[model samples]
Target chain A: MTQVIISPAKANSMYWLGRYTERVYLELHLLRICFDFMIDGKPEEYNRYLASIGNTFLYPDLAAIRSGLVHDKNNPVSVLACVEMANDNAILLRDEIMSPTLGYIQMSLEYLRHAAAESKEPDLDELQKLTDWMLAFWGSIEERVYDERVKNFLRLGKLIEHLDMNIRFSYKFYRIEEAFTSLLKCYDFEPRAFSGDALEDLKKLITEQEYDPRDPVYVNKVLLLLGKVVIL
Target chain B: MQSLIKNRDSVNRWMERYGVRFGVYKNGVFNEQLFPFDSIPRIIEKEDWKVLEKGLIQRVKALNAFLWDIYHDKHIIADGVVPEEFVYASKGYMPECEKVDPTGKVYSHISGIDLVEGKDGRWFILEDNLRIPSGASYPMIAREITRKVSPITFVENHVADNRDYATILKEMMDDMNGGRGINVILTPGRYNSAFFEHSYLAEKTGAVLAFPGDMTVEDDIVWYTGLFNEKIRVGAIYRRISDEYLDPLAFESSSLLGVPNLFQAYKKGTVAVINGFGNGVADDKGIYYFVPKMIRYYLDEEPILHNAPTYLPYFKEDYDYILENISRLVIKDVSEAGGYGVVFGRDLSLEKLSELKELIIHQPRRWIAQEVIDFKDLEILESNEKVERKADLRAFVVSSGKDVKVWKSGLTRFSRNPDSFVVNSSQGGGFKDTWIMD
Candidate 1:
């Protein structure tokens, strides 16, 4: 393998590209579940969904929720904004991540723009295609990116985002533990970006006998510790 | 060829899928628009391509020789082959580059020479873009898509493969670097007009795509700043930024897009800067009138290519002739490029014509007049209908050490407007792929 030199700015971009792409993918998945619940006449499920992502905006109805979560450019956590952010970073890292890998993000952004222009209800089928593209994007990265360092940085971001989202949604302890284990493996690739003390503290907190995954205080503690683990 | 044309929409959709775009700024706002690709290629037969290849190689060699001469011994100026006034007065001539030698003594590692075929079946040299010429990537990527969309087009046509452009480019960069360190393509940033080409070439050539501040020079050694603050040496830089905005401390002190001591590192022979500095003196519009003479003076041979019938206003006889034929010639301001500062005398009103003539007369050294060549119009597909449009070819020449090679395929850019002759992408023109028959 050729010696790959990743500058600080490019490292930051790669990390965020991984984070935002994963954010968009997981958000779409969560939105589908919430939309299915709303279809069953559980309209307040939208408020619970917003609270899980730490969004304070109280969307009035399903239409408002759909518009706010998917099309609103002003909302930083909106699907459109996250996709755009992923694209901006991908543009910066074009040479690191080949064009075929970046093309998936570009296609997703183009689709969302067209959907937003029509101002119709979010199409679930189209969103499924987007999720598939996101999966393809990661698959391309794994196949096309030869530099191990580049892949490691990107995977670190992906693992970090997965753990964050899993904690936010209060997933099972075993699933969160599995994500943490995968994140640690990525951290082993570039341990300098991680804090040793923070990693130990987080591990201790997660594995403690009294630890409860559903407790808000325990979840907040894990979230704070997860944020501190990656200094970069 | 018919199959390729039939699949034009599929080719374009693939282009969009690959994010093929160029950025343009209008009214201080930046916009990235897809570079429109016409399916119909400008085909060059084997016999014609042989002559063109030889001519381009000869022309670029002479130009490189001229750059070396003007910057060093200046024998051309001393022997009265090229005037001293034309050399020193050019905006491209940098006094700071008097004795700085590039690695391998190759000034123009990459040269984009523009040419137009006249109606009489003769090709005329339009311009020599030795300073950071682009558009090679447009056709390079287009060929990738065209081949994928219409496989039969390749099976039927004996077209030369242009995919080796990246290989040749990588070879040139490696030759220049001489194994001193890794090679890098220095770009201003993502907002620049040719950012796509910059990143694309970097990906293709396996060179690090570096932006401003990604590199720093300390003690005349250029280094790429790693993520953990470790410094890696950089040997050769195929810089895409213009000369004036290259090094802040050397040229433009207020330029935030340049490394502070990069020029120092280059001058110290620690780094090889591709298309070496002070090349503007050779490609200047006024200096273009002397390229044929340069060919004879430097190469001791007759010119292989013909420059357009150009008149330099700095000369007394050509000045008088230009004044008499003001309405028929095209006046060009030597300082401006990218289809700017070009005026056809016939397009000007009587008042505008008088004002232009006054400007030319006052700044005689800053203007050149050329008799517009009646170039052949190429047929392009527009709205599913065929129409003839003015087109020109930009052939890329890569010089690695003492060897020079011209890429077989060139960028065939055509004006979208029926009456316009400018084919620059900045002026809203589209491009087509140039196919060189094997």
Candidate 2:
């Protein structure tokens, strides 16, 4: 357990790893919620779910968006893109995170690639598989990562992104509080100077703000502050 | 052999799942394609390996001594065993590396010596890749999966276990730990051609797989910085990057991939740079012609291995021979590598041959011509059938802690194109494992 010096480049990469894993993990959650819509002949239902995740263009319709998420290599928010990025960062952290721990991420990416090559539609079954892998990745992060500081950094990213997604989709009040609490726990392990004021502000907002899904200005500000809260 | 061939596809599938691919960049686009594995292995008999092991060890010892000598005293050059001008004129020779000695005076800790078996069944040394040699990990990882795919093959054959490459590499790095800090494999980035080997070796050796940006020099020592701001001192860097890009200040000032003042840390003996900074002089194409002389000069021994029938245009007699037999020889530019800058005379048109002759005559020291050896071809699986392909072996020799050891396995690269003799992975060549019979 050599002391981990999070170089600027690696910190930046891990920050993105956190965001991308959460993006894949949670986006698939959104897709799973919308999957039944597409399959039950209620594509508009799927379109509304897509809108909630900030997808502006619903044109070219259900099949395209459904397949695009899992199949498109260029899709910035695609599951394939997110999983690939997560695995790439994991490669950088090969010493910090073992390969058997990264096995889940690798399998998930390989599955997505195979489905794309086979021209399989993005369906509930594939979504479930991705969900399982993402969960396993988080589990591995907790159980397998050697150094506590390394785990803390990854968890910091994961928690920040979890908070960002929670705010973006306006999850239930209890879910927001739970994610916020988890982020606080992970950020405490970091031995650097971070904003206690910012954390306190965000905590106050979470506890006191009126529940409104449409008024995301305050939520966006909190997200910005969350990005800044981790100092490095 | 039959069962191994039958299960080749499954082995390859496992390889794919394990990301056993090489990266190539062309026209500014990077593509990672699998380094296809052929089922038919190139087997080396124990008796043959006995001779090869001795030769490889002797050759590398000579090469390492040559590197150390070239950097410190000029005994070999001053004695006129090798011309001083020829030694200094090589682009691989670094003037900044003068008088710097690594731990145990081992410059090439790991050496990839390329050899070919002639039709007469005698092996001829083709190349010495002292500067940042690769491909050991290819066979190491491939054999792991192949063994799993067909365990019966190993149970029957008296093959030496190849899985000890990682252990050997770790011991080498650990023994060469000059600063007693962490050992790291410094790669330029994932986009480099051999990134897979870099990452895989790091994983196998438990060394930190560090990018150029992930490390920095402080107080004349190298340090590995992790994602949580924890910094560990790095004693030995098994650098996969090229020499020119090693340190921006000492070599290519424009190379951001290199750490600033890292060469100074190495110079101060605060770090051990495996396959030391100025090894190119020993493995230089022009200098390769002088290896036998080096063996005689340094070790007072006769050369056990034979270099190919080679002609250096820099010499008067060799130049006359090259000029006379321009159509029957293979000319290689000393500066070019990875199957590039190699031209067989028969493959050249009459006009091209004449142009090459002019280039050789004017820049005589730039090229070396060799008589083409009709090397024995090995049959490989091609579309479920056996096809004979030209292949060469790259045997890894590691000098660790005052001793040199050659691995029992090697990477056997073969040409994918039927008419071509180029067998570099960068040139779309495929590879198979080399089994040393126990």
How far residue A203's Cα lies from its native spot in candidate 1, in Å, is 2.6
Alpha carbon lDDT at A88, candidate 1: 94
Worst 10 residues of 1 chain A by lDDT: A205-214
> Candidate 2 — which residues are off by over 4 angstroms?
A1-4, A40-44, A117-119, A139-143, A191-194, A208-214, B225-230
In order, candidate lDDTs are 0.89, 0.84
How good is model 2 by TM-score?
0.94
Q: What does fnat come to for each candidate?
A: 0.67, 0.46
Worst ten-residue run, lDDT, model 2 chain B?
B223-232
| lDDT against true structure, model 2 | 0.84
Question: What is the per-candidate TM-score for chain B?
Answer: 0.99, 0.98
Q: TM-scores for all candidates?
A: 0.97, 0.94
User: Residues A62-95, candidate 1, lDDT per residue (tens digit)?
Assistant: 7888777888767888888899999999998888
- What shift in Å separates residue B309 of candidate 2 from its native position after superposition? 0.9
